[model samples]
Target chain A: MHSRTSFSVLIFILLIWEILVNLLHIPKFILPAPSLIIYTCFSQAPLLLENTLVTAVEILLGLMISLAISIPLAIVMFSFPSVDAAITPFLVISQAIPIFALAPLLVVWFGYGLLSKIIMATIVIFFPLTVSLHSGFKQVDPDYEVLFDLLDASFWKKMRFLYWPAALPSFFAGLKMAVAVATIGAVLGEWVGAQKGLGYLMIQMNARLRTDMLFAALVWLSAMGMGMWLLVGKLEKHFLFWLNDTKN
Target chain B: MLRVCDISKIYSDLAVFTNISFMVEKGSFAAFLGPSGCGKSTLFRVIAGIESSDSGHIEWEGLKLLNLKENTAMMLQKDLLLPWFDILDNVLIPIKTLKRDTKTGESEAKRLLSRFGLSGFEHYLPYQISGGMRQRAALVRTLLFDREIFLLDEPLSALDALTRQSLQKEILRIQLEFDKTVLMITHDIMEALMLADKIFLLSHLPMRIIKEIDLSNLPKPRYHLDFELAEMAENIFFTLKGELINA
Candidate 1:
């Protein structure tokens, strides 16, 4: 019921946008009409779909690699404060450096392949995942630890039962932010230098003033970002049912 | 029997407790009745080997219990129920840690919860339940470990009067039924009188055991009691009051 209202509001805005673009007689180069963009999206669907798939693969792989690295990094930092103290400042500095600024350097060093783009997305993903998960591990109620200790719990048992369950909510929080940034990172890396991606296509169309295709590519990127975000939200709801007030 | 001898703990420059010596007999219910902030919880921690005393020796059945946590199951004052886990998962924590058969362990947890009047609450998280229910779940978790001794650190302090009285009776019954030795810490004199087979009354810091009373002769359902038990409760209250006055 709530979603239907939002969907109607979106359609209403799009109809107004289409009417205004047609009535004002805006040129196709500066701002294409919604109809022109939709036509371009469908007519050139095969080419656009290929680029979208490439970008999606990069973002998804980058996110998977980030998870592989950051969860363990967060665990190590939580387990040993001295390691956290040694490494945390550098991690903060890495996030402080803008990804756009790093994109050219990454392309140059990693040689403009899928590897460079994946690295860029990973760079964007690693910080939030580590920081949020580290906070989760550190912020547990002291009472919980005392209970585990009283049980004579082994280290692995404590990690599996206590730390894992306790940190899941925060890990999901980090995952939401990380997945959102992943698309941007993939596009930015492609913008620097890539042979085939939506970012590469956008650069090509903008240079030649094929503004309809450029807008179509932007639309696809936005759709991809929203799709990933919605996926994470769904996962949160399914796994964190215990937090809800309802019986189910 | 568990013996704690010459236990003294000094925090920083100040002494929290000194020369705290006591013994809890096997299968006996012992209560440490003390004033608030008299380091009763700290003493229990020391005995459980969660913390170390500056000078002390704790032994169970003649063997030194340097790491007593291996054998002692503690129910903290706060229920300390893991917020993420359901009551069944929370109660099965000890079984999971000990690497027991989780299938049978889960069945045992269900039985205990049903016995504790928490039959429909197996899937509920700690926050979904009332304070009394959470306390009952915590007790079930502690009991599942099947430890030789139980350390109850003011377990009923958070409940209302009626709930406290009910739980007091229930715990006394559990002690007798399971033949368990329980060392309970509380500031309620009447509670000590009703449930404890023996009570050790400690004064405020630097805390020491000032009085010990035997309540084994008292009958069951001692909450509202005969004249002799009532007089004994009054005397214990005055003893604690005199310590406050001196302090």
Candidate 2:
């Protein structure tokens, strides 16, 4: 029932757009009708789909790389407090450099290719993952620490038996945020230097005063973000199913 | 057998307790009863080798126990069952971590779960069960370590009254059946009287064993010994209250 209501509301929004564009004589170059955007998407379906795939690949690779690096980094930081103390200031400084300022530098270093975009996404996505996971590791109950010590558990055993499980929920939360932001990071990186991505395609369409095509590219980007978000949600549900039973 | 000698703990120049000494004979049950903030839990941690005292020594069967391999299992006020683990997995945690090869211990855990009325809930996570059930699972986890000595720090204080009573009875049954030495800490004088063969009453702050009472003469089926136990509890309370007055 909620789905139906949302679908109707979306349709209603599109209908209003159509009426305003045709009856009010709004220029197509300024604000294209939803139908025109949909028609442009269909007509340029192959190019649009290819660019979408490139952007998706960049986001996925970047997110995977970030996860691989940051999770172990977090575990290391958690296991050794001095390491955390040493690296935390540098981590903060990394985030302090604006992505806009960093994007062109990344392109210069890595060139106008997937590498630069992937690097951008990694830089953008890693902070939250590391911070969230570190906080989760820090939040392990002292009582459980005592229990672990009493059991004569090894360091790895403590991490496996206690730290990992304690950090999972927070890690998933950070992953969700990373997924959403990763797409934007990929697009931003592409905007600065890439020759073949949805972001570049949108820029080309805008220069040609093809607003409908530009809007169509934007629709694809939004769809990709939502799709990745849903995938993360499904993974979270699959891994943390016990959370649901407890909530209810 | 476990023996603690002149164990004193201080933090940042403030003494938590000092010159505390006690011994637990193999297969005997000892309870520590004190008001809140008496550092009973800290003492338990010291005994379990989870913390170091400023000065003292602990021996388990003639082995110095400070920073040593803990042959003791400790249970806390709140059931610390890992939220992600099912009852069976939670119970098996210590064994899995310690890597002890003991099929007998595993079977003993299973038996204790069923005996304590957690028979069908083995696959359920800690949050899926009630407080009492979770505590029972924790007890089984502690037992699975095959420790000769069990240290319980207010293990049932979080339960509802009825559940607390039931679990207390269950613990007593397990103690008799397993014949393991048990050292428990509690603020409840009634619990001390009902379950303890010997009770140590502790003073506040720099806590020490102010009095020791023997309850071995008390009747079995603890509820039946209520009146006499209540009188003993009152005496404990009087001593504890007097300590507060002196402080």
* DockQ, every prediction: 0.59, 0.75
Clashing pairs in 2: none
With a 3 Å backbone cut-off (N, CA, C), the pairs that clash in candidate 1 are none
Error of 2 at B205 (Å): 1.0
- Count backbone overlaps in model 2: 0
Lowest summed lDDT across 10 adjacent residues in model 2 chain B is found at B63-72
Q: For model 1, what is the error of residue A40's alpha carbon versus the real structure, in angstroms, after optimal superposition?
A: 4.0
> On a 0 to 100 scale, what is the lDDT of residue B222 in model 2?
78
lDDT of 2: 0.86
What is the DockQ score, from 0 to 1, of model 1?
0.59
B34-129: candidate 1 lDDT, tens digit per residue: 888989988888877788889978888899865477778898889988877889999999998888999999999999999999999999888889
lDDT per residue as tens, model 1, A1-248: 98899999988988898898889998899988888998999999899989999999999999989999998999899889999999999999999999999999999999878989999999999899999999988878887888888877876788888887788889899999998888889999999999989999999999999999999999888888889989998998787776644445
Q: Which has the greatest DockQ?
A: 2
